[model samples]
Target: MTSHPTVGHVHLRVADLDRAIAFYRDILGFDVTQQSATAAFLGAGGYHHHIGLNTWDSLNASPPPAGHTGLYHSAFLYPDRASLGTVLCRVAAAGITLDGAADHGVSEAVYLRDPDGNGVELYRDKPQAEWPRNPDGKLAMINARLDVQAIMDEAP
Candidate 1:
């Protein structure tokens, strides 16, 4: 047997390419490394692009109806709580309304919608050495209230 595997970029069809680019680049700090009049690609850590945005198909299209089995959300993982705070602050400064925030036992996250109502999640993982686990050593993940104020305090 031969083995080679990898997960590549995630492409999204958004209603407005520029708006999506602004949300991902300006608010989320993803570098817009490539773009055309109708398409844009963004990334972090010098990779080609982690996200590709284009309006080839969904231009002016309404968001997917709720209760559907499509993408729930796409999460951008930050390296640390401080960096997550940076994103939270950016979201605040951008006047974006937050839909929800939570501590998922192993990670802290903030949720909000882009201009086209697509869900975006910004999160930070807790150190694995300190993650909560069961007696059998399995992760004990659950949705819990995240300390938004405390996370903000970590900023600057």
Candidate 2:
């Protein structure tokens, strides 16, 4: 594997294809590249896909029970704080309640669940020079309350 390889995409099993599409497309603003009765591929900036939603084996299936080992969340990184805030506003307008919001020293993030109950995180990273570091130069990440209103103020 290449040392600099990046995560290409995330594929999720969803109970309803259309509902998932509405959330990812209408709410989060990803463009739908391709879709079928059982699956859909969505992307940003015209890449092939950053997210894949499917109902092949999971059609109408319920989300996994709590405490079971499974995916924690799939995070989407916005290009900047304004972009992140813009999407956060859309989520709020759509009546989606955020699970949490935090400043993690290097980034600000908002957490929520998709229509199928899959965890999702939307965030924007601060510049490398702004990341917190310990005296030894190691990262010193902290979870602190993020002023979501401040971010919204920066949105277009």
Model 1 weakest 10-residue run by lDDT:
5-14
Q: Provide TM-scores for the models.
A: 0.92, 0.96
- lDDT of each structure? 0.88, 0.95
Clashing pairs for model 1 are: none
lDDT of 1 by residue, 63-116 (tens): 988888877788889998888888888889998889999998899999988887
Q: Model 1, residue 151: what's the lDDT? A: 91
What stretches of model 2 exceed 4 Å from their correct place?
none
Error of 1 at 5 (Å): 5.3
- Model 1 CA RMSD to the hidden true structure, in angstroms: 1.9
Query: Could you give me the TM-score of model 1 versus the true structure?
Result: 0.92
User: Model 1: residues >4 Å from true position, as ranges?
Assistant: 1-6
Query: Candidate 1 overall Cα lDDT vs. reference?
Result: 0.88
